[model samples]
Target chain A: DVKVTQSSRYLVKRTGEKVFLECVQDMDHENMFWYRQDPGLGLRLIYFSYDVKMKEKGDIPEGYSVSREKKERFSLILESASTNQTSMYLCATTAGPYNEQFFGPGTRLTVL
Target chain B: AQSVTQPDIHITVSEGASLELRCNYSYGATPYLFWYVQSPGQGLQLLLKYFSGDTLVQGIKGFEAEFKRSQSSFNLRKPSVHWSDAAEYFCASGYFGNEKLTFGTGTRLTIIP
Candidate 1:
């Protein structure tokens, strides 16, 4: 079975603070993704990485960035957090562009 | 651009009852269809996917979906509803490779004992 693990399950931060959400996968997948889930909006992609050091923006990437220094780890960074940035963040890894993804539990972020 | 639609916002069914969730898609050609379930704070789990071959596909957790090319629909069905079946279900569609999936608003399901 594939396992995707997130660094934090829940987090709270103040406005203008820096926030980092980490994800790691044991499956050696080449593709990793970050998405923010919201009510009525469903899951909207924030960023995705196809390989180490290669990143692509998705539906929404404002105020957020990602890092993929290692193949097994992907990190989501909020340069400066804001209240509007509060959301449930999810990370997933796949074998390739067109493959089933294994997702981490998720991190519920709260910005105040 | 490809898009997906899950018409029903919420569906309720008693335990042991049959279940069905409607999903519709809009794409130029045959799209890759997927169904996922989310439980509370957990991430989405792949229940099934439709790429090629047979129109009907079976998934984990006792779920099955049939793809209708004529209607551009992939509706999920279950023979019996379990209490653990209560969760948010999403329908998604995309092309082969490098294409991002567009998800529906999702349908919240409730199981009555």
Candidate 2:
């Protein structure tokens, strides 16, 4: 079975503070993704990484960035957090395109 | 651009009752269809996927989905609903070999015991 783990299940941060959400996968997948889920809006992609040091912006990439220094780890960074940034962040990894994706539990971020 | 739509926002069903969730997609070519379930405060889990060959696909947790090319629909069905089946279900579509998937708003299911 594939396992995807997030660094934190919940987090709280003040406005203008920096926030980092980490995700790690044990399946050695080549594609990793970050998404924010909201009620009535579903899951919106924030960023995705196809390979180490290669990142692509998703539909809603504003106010967020990503880092993929290694194959197993992908990190989402909020340079300066704001209240509007509060959301349930999810991380997913897939071994190849057109394959099933494994997701982490998710990190619920609260930006006050 | 490909898109997915899940018409029902919320559904209520009694235990042991039949269940069906509707999903439709808009894409130029043959799209990759998937159904995912997410428990409260949890990440999304793949229930099933429809790429090719078999239009009807079976998934875990006693769930199944059928793809209709004529209607551009991939509806999920379950013979018997259980209380534990309550969760948010999403329909997603993607292009072949695409890295991103377009997801629907999701339907929240409530199972009555």
Q: lDDT of all predictions, in order shown?
A: 0.92, 0.93
Model 2 stretches with alpha carbons more than 4 Å out: none
DockQ in order: 0.62, 0.73
Score candidate 2 by TM-score against the native: 0.98
lDDT of 2 by residue, B56-93 (tens): 99999999999999999999999999999999999998
* After superposition, candidate 1 runs with Cα above 4 Å error: none
Interface RMSD, every prediction, one decimal place: 1.6, 1.2
- Worst 10-residue stretch by lDDT in candidate 2 chain A? A94-103
lDDT of 1 at B30: 85
- Candidate 1 TM-score to native: 0.97
RMSD value for candidate 2: 0.8
